[model samples]
Target: MKNTIAERIFDFLKDFPPFDVLTAEQLIIIARNVKVIYLPKDKFVFKIEEEIHDHFYVVKDGAIGIFRKEDQVLVDECDEGDIFGLRAMIRKGNYILSAKAIEESIVYSISSLLLEEIIQTNTEANKFLIASFATNTRNPYANDNKGTLFANVKSLQKNESSLTEVQSAQYSKNPITCQLKTSIQQAALIMSTKHVGSIVITENQKPIGIITDKDLRLHIATGRFSIDDPVESIMSSPVITYPENISVAEAQIAMLQHKITHLCITKDGTANSVLTGILSEHDIVAIRGNNPSALIKEVKRAKTAETLQHIRKKVQQLLQGYVEQHIPISYISKVISAINEAITQRAILLSLEEMNTPPPVKFSWLALGSQGRKEQLLITDQDNALVFENPPKEQFDVTKAYFLSLSEKVTQKLNTIGFEFCPADMMASNPRWCLSLDEWKNQFHSWITKPDKDKILLSMIFFDYEMIYGDKNLVDEMSESIFGSIGSYKIFLNFMGLNALKNPPPLSFFRQFLVEHSGEHKDQFDIKARAIMPLVDAARLLILSNNLKGFNSTIARYKKLAEVEPQNKDLYESCINAFRVLLRFRTQQGLKNNTSGRFIDLKSLSKADRLKLKGCFKPIKDIQELIKVRFSLSHML
Candidate 1:
């Protein structure tokens, strides 16, 4: 029962990941199930499309070269502690890559079933083993996969378990309120002072009407009505009411169906009942993070900017966990975007409170640049703008002033929360960027029509905007306006394609990493400029030229491109894989150095990591060539 050889395998695996993160008791369960085999140098472990072993392999000694069966060129070299054969376990697809021993090897073949049990919650292991071909390096213990990494991830497990959507959710006990007799000034004073988004207008402890931030902004702040008017005058009558014991799922569906944020909670489930509490999107967002639903819950309850800042840090940990667990890039983007947008929404509400007044006009907060693309992985400089519904000409200055004041507070709080201010002052607080819907539309048209280098550069960044919070209709119309402009002036796509080609393929003729030449980043590899941006630019331009909409993510764009242009599927697929690795590499560097992961120190990378980096460049080169051919840019070049 002792099995000395198996014990030795356990000892080695325990020192590495999913295993390292596991307990001795847990490792014992796994170590007992492993199958050890000897592989002499140049001998094959498994041939391509060979029947996959029920177990995955880990190297105990020597290195294994994983080769594409087609060309037989080694794609990755796995040394001690590296994993292989995981994809086969997951996909049961015939081995796409063959593994061979480059030197005499002692391999521990781990029972896939055993790993599934022992590290069931070990997302770190799941992330580590997500893609077998991804293992060019030694260990995958760097990030918390939060137990979502493996085949047993059970995508809906959290929903089935943690979210008892039928069970009554905890509602706010102390509901903020205003009486019908209350003046608009009194109501605004109450809302601003208490920092609530809405006030239930009640009579005889029964919900009668409601006034929200939106109501205040549209009806009074824009000079539509005087502050002296009774709150009832502008209140949305017959307040949407729910019972105090309503389920989280019910609350969400109701909010969506009614197109409302605040729902009045009553002693009974109907509008005729006595007001007991209020549920809002704020309440739903605060449902708790045992699941994704719970994660947003913490984001919702962040009372102070500092609290939201703290949540932002937690979001980073979650992000790192997702990356570590090898979650799909698309899913990761959606999760992070939810967290990010929630934070921005919370901050915006808080900012409104700080201003002692509601927004002067209906407005939306738009996240620009990378955030717009929803591809933001690491915290970077804030690129944002404010777009408001245009006010009457006489009230424009006062309206702009109110929004500018709110933006200043929000941006400062966001800065405190760790999103650094945009060095170029392209934030909502900047008058140049903050504009009426008409103004933003005109600015976008100018950028498209002019086609000058400065304007083109602006267009590249400004065009991919996504609304973080506020009015969705405003953003939709603005997007419509932008596409209309692009439709008429189609030459802009050519200009954009030209601009996207600014950063050439990331390798020299020698296949070396093309690093920066001088300035603050001398001798450093500018991964963002040379590697990441090229793909980002390519994806954006491709989508734009095709007149596609709603795909802001680079990975999504690439995935779509592969779908529409099936001829380029392999190329797009390769680009996606490469992009994932490069992005992960950048994040690792950024987390390690406490700086942006843009400038990588090539000397710091191991030979294996360097090889992996090189592997990712091929797709970049191929994509650029495609772009050049598609745009007919040989003459321009």
Candidate 2:
């Protein structure tokens, strides 16, 4: 009997792993007994605890879900070229997982009897089986316990999955090691051969100390010691050792704690245990790619503004990937905020290097408006302030002039990086914003105590100011001043609360969006100012009343408010959830249209999106009710 279809199956199988290692003739022989099968969506190929079949299945098309027995949790989805059900078959055990077709699918099953026969004689195939089996033991696809794996597999092939948060970090398992008795020359020679900067010194395979190139240069090359010195003479003893399972963050912390660049990983997480590997700060950093800290380091290391510009572009690319991967919008915002703050700091650092004289005293750099709130998603206007420590009477004018010039350069660079200077000139470059810490306190004191309509409007915007870069003491001093002033002026929060309720959610009497009465956006609703800012401003006002100083973000303020006041928990939780949805919607709209996303077309949204938007209004209404009662704004109205 000629197995024509089995021969075709063998041809496809020979091109992929494990099977690829099998000889052409060996593969064709196994293929003769292969089972060609098809499954419809939701049809089970095998159930949990079922006895193992003689054959293992390989997906030919569509997808098959391998679900955990409990709660029917999907562990992995096997699509084309993916193999499953083999481990149970080869081990002669009952199936621990259930496999069902996620979509109508076709598969080919290869007999384990034939697999064992071919693998025994074929060394390459045997080795491939061992490696594949080892990987399966680790449960590489465990995180996708309930997720559709097919959605991620296509991107995996393109290497785009590496940018995703779900991707696992790759770490070194086999570390460079040497005996403590080895001469510095021998260790240095080994390092040079291996192209490594650091080597671990061990005793009976237990990590004892570490020696890096820096030590050799500082101790040996400077004529202080000879090249024949034992590696222990210059070795940094009592080396830091972390578990072999250390996360990227743990590795970073270990590096900082020891003030050393390398960490030894051991079997049981102690210096007495056998060394399994070394995790260099460089290694951790390489795998920590796309994080906020890494991006900042890249910006600092950048020799040219053009290089910084390129890193900024990568930041945007990372942001897009985060959004597409469905990372929580709040988390995405924090990471981007950190990157933005780092960029500003790097710009400041570079500008200081360019300046002839250093800043005279401690100062605070404030990001005013949306950026101050850490809510600036797109590159919007540059709204910032610089508050310096009060200068002596003699140096006042000279110090002020010098800092102002520095602010101008920093602002210009920020403008180049896409943050447009505020049209109203609300920047540190403006003399009004750049002031002494005492002056800023006095400025806020006047606004809070007096509180005219204009002053109230200014206070509402300025009160959320976040310190982007500067001396911590200066920012802390400013916050203390604001809180102190507010203590004497309890009415300020009432006024601020009244101001927040002014916009009224932008919904008309018929539950339809109310477009602007007149302006460039006359026919379009102002989502930012009307729907978003009012809620953000209200959250800040409410939280500040409870003596919260640093709560800048709207959602975070509401969350904190919920924690302190349990009676308002539901309302605050609703606001946080609503804000997340709105933010997600705005970012999606902005990405699609390449605009500010402040004005969303009501007609453009789907029925489900519109329904979700409507759902958000319930919290908006409830919060406004609380504000009206607490502020006595009903009398004001």
Predicted candidate 1 versus true structure: per-residue lDDT over 1-637, tens digit per residue: 3658668767677655557667788788888878888998888888887888888888776668787633355556565567777877777678867899876788888888888786567765665555333432222333321111222222312223223333466777788988898999999999999998888898888889999999989999799999999998999988887666666545654664576777888875577878888887766666634334455677787789899888888777656544554444555666677778888889998888777777878999999988898877789999999999999999999999988988999999999989999998989999998899999999999998888999988888887788888999999898889889999998888888888889888888988888878999898999998888889899999988777888887898899999999999878877887787777778767767778788989998755457667767878889989988998887997
- Candidate 1, residue 158: the lDDT equals 25
RMSD of every prediction: 14.4, 12.6
- The TM-score measured for candidate 2 stands at 0.64
lDDT of 2 by residue, 175-237 (tens): 787887789899999999998888899999999999998999999889887788888999999
RMSD of candidate 2 to true structure, Å: 12.6
Give all TM-scores, in the order shown: 0.61, 0.64
Residue 325 error for model 2, in Å?
0.4
| TM-score of model number 1 | 0.61
Over 4 Å off, model 1: 1-82, 86-292
Please estimate how well model 2 matches the true structure, expressed as its whole-model Cα lDDT.
0.75
Candidate models: Cα lDDT each: 0.77, 0.75
